[model samples]
Target: MNFRLFSQLSSYHADIKRLIKIALPILLAQIAQNSMGLVDTIMAGRVSATDMAAISVGASIWLPLVLFGHGLLLALPPTVSYLNGSGQQHRIAHQIRQGIWIALASCIPLGILIYYSDFALRFMQMEPHMAHIAQDYLHAMLWGLPAYLLLMNFRCLNDGIAKTKPAMVITFLGLMLNIPLNYIFIYGKLGIPAFGAVGCGIATAIVNWSMCLMMIGYSYFNRQERKLQVFSQIIEKPNAATLKKLLQLGLPIAIALCCEVALFAITALLLSPLGANIVASHQIALNTSSLIFMFPMSIGMATTILVGQALGAGAPEKAKKLSYAALLLGLTLTVVTAFITIFYRYQIAAIFVTDEIVIGMAATLLFLAAIYQFSDTVQVVVGGVLRGYKDTKVILYITLFSYWVIGIPLGYVLARTDLLMPSIGAQGFWLAFVVSLTFAAVLLFYRMRKTQSLSDDVLMARLEKLK
Candidate 1:
């Protein structure tokens, strides 16, 4: 019995090491991607609290739109993962061509929506000054939409085939450019006119285009990409069946992403009535949490690719073990992160604003955030693994129940004088976040377990038959 236990432990450790090898580049890529937004927030915050609030509101609008597009384009990676696993190198270029077409198709409508976001902000009834700041930021951000979407498709394709290093390098290069670009645009340095938030948008657009071009150039010249034939096949026309398959896989992810984002967006909307101070504080906490979240989020993405490729290779047991290994790693990392947030809550809060009330409120929310990290880590990683299994419909239901059925209502009651508890305001919202994330974690884990039990060969056979 002792020998068996030791052997099992050794096996588990080996699996974890393998998982880390796959997950690290993905984690770094996510960190770089998230750092761009964090830089924008910090730069905007330094300009003024109102500038921070404006960016927050604009982000509340912009992030969901961008994430929605990203979710739809997410289909590319899993498709590429499967094809790569099956050793269909020639088919990859065709899929990439189709992905680009789909990305462009999706980008056009989203660009139009972003272009009209200023008009939409008018309906939100924010204070006039805040509204103007938000409008400026949104308008500037609009130009990056197409470029960003195209880059997302490229990143997804690269990541799907387990070539995450290219995506990471491109993202890191973009982050390097983003800081100086933000400084130039936000502060109007180097004898340029001060653009403030508007400049942020322009810098972001430039970075987006730059990243896309760089990825394209890298893929063209890289020996690995050449060996993989990622650009060798010439697709002369759109494949309707392939496009439909991509949408079928991607749309649920988009809805799932939108549902979670909509929950936070609504939270922002609800907090707005409390005062700019509260809203500003919430944004601070939100932005901080978002930056920290990239760690697990990257792990989740890696989990999807690893599990999906394993499934494609007809290795159900391997997929299951990989998912569990990734979850364990994510949980461990989040626990360490939670400790940091708990101990440094006040210090982190102070970075966002000078206002005492905002600082205090943000500190309180950070404590709640610390408590939910484990749950958030679980939900995100498990959901990613499930996405790899192509089991997203249940996730849509899970998010709906957890976020709206439980989280939002509890928040409403706690935040206002609408229930038994005293008005806890935004802190109340954080409590609801903890509850919702916990519920989501439990449900997603259950779904992942259910998915892992199925035979990968059967699933792939079914998919092939459909094809």
Candidate 2:
């Protein structure tokens, strides 16, 4: 009995190591991408408060739209993973070509929305000068939209095959380029006129296009990728059926992402009237949570790739094992992060602010944030596993209900109204997050089990075919 337990522990450890190998590069790439945003904010703040606000405001708008595109293009990676596992390598180029077309088609409308995002700013009645700066930033970012989408497309292709290191290198290089580019354009270096915050947009656009080209070049030259000949079919006409399938699989994921993003966004708006200190504290805690979130999020992405590959190989049992290992691994990592957040909460908050009250309040919120990591890790990993099985509609349903129907309403009542006892301010929202995310995690786990049970038959059928 002890030996059996030891053997199971060994299996889990090996699977965890494999998942980490794929996840580490992805985590680094995500960090580098986020660092670019941090650079923009810090540099813009140095110029003026209004410039910094404009950059933040502009990012809040564009980032969600970017995530929408990202969600849609996410259909590609699992598809590529499946094809690669099924020994249908020849079909991957066609799949990738279709993905490119979808990206192009989606880019047109998203670009229009971004370019005219100033309308929303106008409606918000923002300060005229800051609004204008924000508008300019969005328009500048518009130029990079296509490159950004395509970069994601090919990056997904590489991720599907577990070739994540190249993306990490390329993205780090982009981050290196952004610092100087921002310096040049923001400060009027090398005889260029200073554009201030707008320069961040310009720099980001250049970096996006640069990274896109790099990934494309890598795909063309890398021996494994070269055989797929993704670039060779760059201009392949879109298939109506293929496009529909991609949309059907992708749009729900996009909407689900929007729902989750909107929850936090709306929460901030609701919390605005509470006072600047409250908002600042909330932002501090939220930012810290988001940074720590990268760890489990990377594991989730790896789960999607690994599980899809297993399923494609007609190994449902293997896919189930991988999913379980990934969940355990994600939970374990979050526990470590949570412990750090809890023990060093005051220190973490202090890094963001020197104000004693804000630091104390943010530290308190960080404790609540740490509590929610377990739920967050579970839901995210299960979401990734569901994507592997091409079952995304359930995720959309669950998040919409959990975040909108349950989390937000509960938070609003607890934070603002006396109906649920005296207002608790930001802590209420953190509690809501814990509740909603835990609700999501439970529902997702059941759904995953259901999927696993159903897939066993699929495995047997495939084996029969082979026989």
**Least accurate 10 contiguous residues by lDDT in model 1:** 458-467
lDDT of 2 by residue, 361-460 (tens): 9999999999999999999999999888878889999999889999999999999998979999999999999999999999999999987887577744
TM-score of each: 0.91, 0.97
lDDT of 1 at 393: 73
Model 1 Cα lDDT, one tens digit per residue, 314-376 = 777877888888888888898899999999999999987888888988999998999999999
Poorly placed runs, candidate 2 (over 4 Å): 458-467
Q: Give the range of the ten consecutive residues with the poorest summed lDDT in model 2.
A: 458-467
> How many residue pairs clash per model?
0, 0
Candidate 2, residue 128: lDDT: 99
Model 1 whole-model lDDT (C-alpha atoms): 0.83
Per-residue error for 453 in candidate 2, Å, reads 1.1
